[model samples]
Target: MTKETKKYNKWIVILSITIPLVVAILFGVKIDAELPVFLPPIYASINALTSIVLIASFWAIKNKKVKLHENLMKTAIIFSVVFLVLYVAYHMTSNSTKFGGEGNLRIVYFIILISHIILSIAVIPFVLITYVRAITNNIELHKKIAKFTFPLWLYVAISGVVVYLMISPYY
Candidate 1:
């Protein structure tokens, strides 16, 4: 196998095992009573920032500004990291937010929610693969997977905001 292939395969194994295990363990762990409440807007804002940066990164690459593109991608990754940290922190501390919508819009809320959930889970492997391809200098393969990754990431970000807005009332 090519060196890049071997590297990526190793990364895939590590991340594939690590992420889900972390999620599973974290998902069930209980926290202290009377946990501090975090403002959802802040986390939602991070998601918005991620989407904006992703779009800017796309524009940067389209213009062949490679360094700028890399910086933007790094910024996007940072935002994603920050978001995840806060998200898990919030969930661990506070009770899960419930959907408080009533009527037709309730359906709309759930639709957004279901899509958000499925896309969020789906995005994990895509992001890992996309990152691996880019880091390994497999630009051709990266670009091919990127077209899929970008939209899915965008959907996740946008839906994050949607979910926050929908559930904020109940929190």
Candidate 2:
């Protein structure tokens, strides 16, 4: 591995570990007083924006616009990070909104929510590894991993919006 890739590997590990742990801890925490209750819509919009950016990034690479693709991917990563921060903050301060759908819809919502949660966690490492490969100029490896990463990442993004929509009425 290149030195650059090695340098990022440590960060990848640290972020992959820390993000979920912190989010899990914050998920259980609820403040006694109310704060500004704007995070849900903002983070949901971020997730929708991320899905758009991911699709645009894919199109950029398909047209051989490598630099554009890189920038868009970077933006997507930033969106994800911002979304995480806001999501954790919202959960920490407010109660979790439960899904209020009926029987079949509730089941469907849970399925999507479960898959989104698991894949959202999985996508973090894949994203970091793909980003490291790209930055290190390992185009072959980057492309290989990105083929898997893109769909998973997109699903996580879109599902986030869906999950929010399903639960928003209860919030």
> Number of the top candidate by TM-score?
2
lDDT of 1 by residue, 13-123 (tens): 787668667766886876885545564788899999999999999999999998998899889888988887777776666777778779998999999988987877778
RMSD (Cα, Å) for all candidates, in order, is: 1.9, 1.3
Position 104, candidate 2: lDDT: 94
TM-score, every prediction:
0.89, 0.94
TM-score quality measure for candidate 1: 0.89
For model 1, which pairs clash?
Answer: none
Give per-candidate clash totals: 0, 0
lDDT of 2 by residue, 56-94 (tens): 999999999999999999999999999998888887787
Off by over 4 Å in 2: none
Model 2, residue 126: C-alpha shift (Å): 0.2
The Cα RMSD of model 2 versus the native structure comes to: 1.3
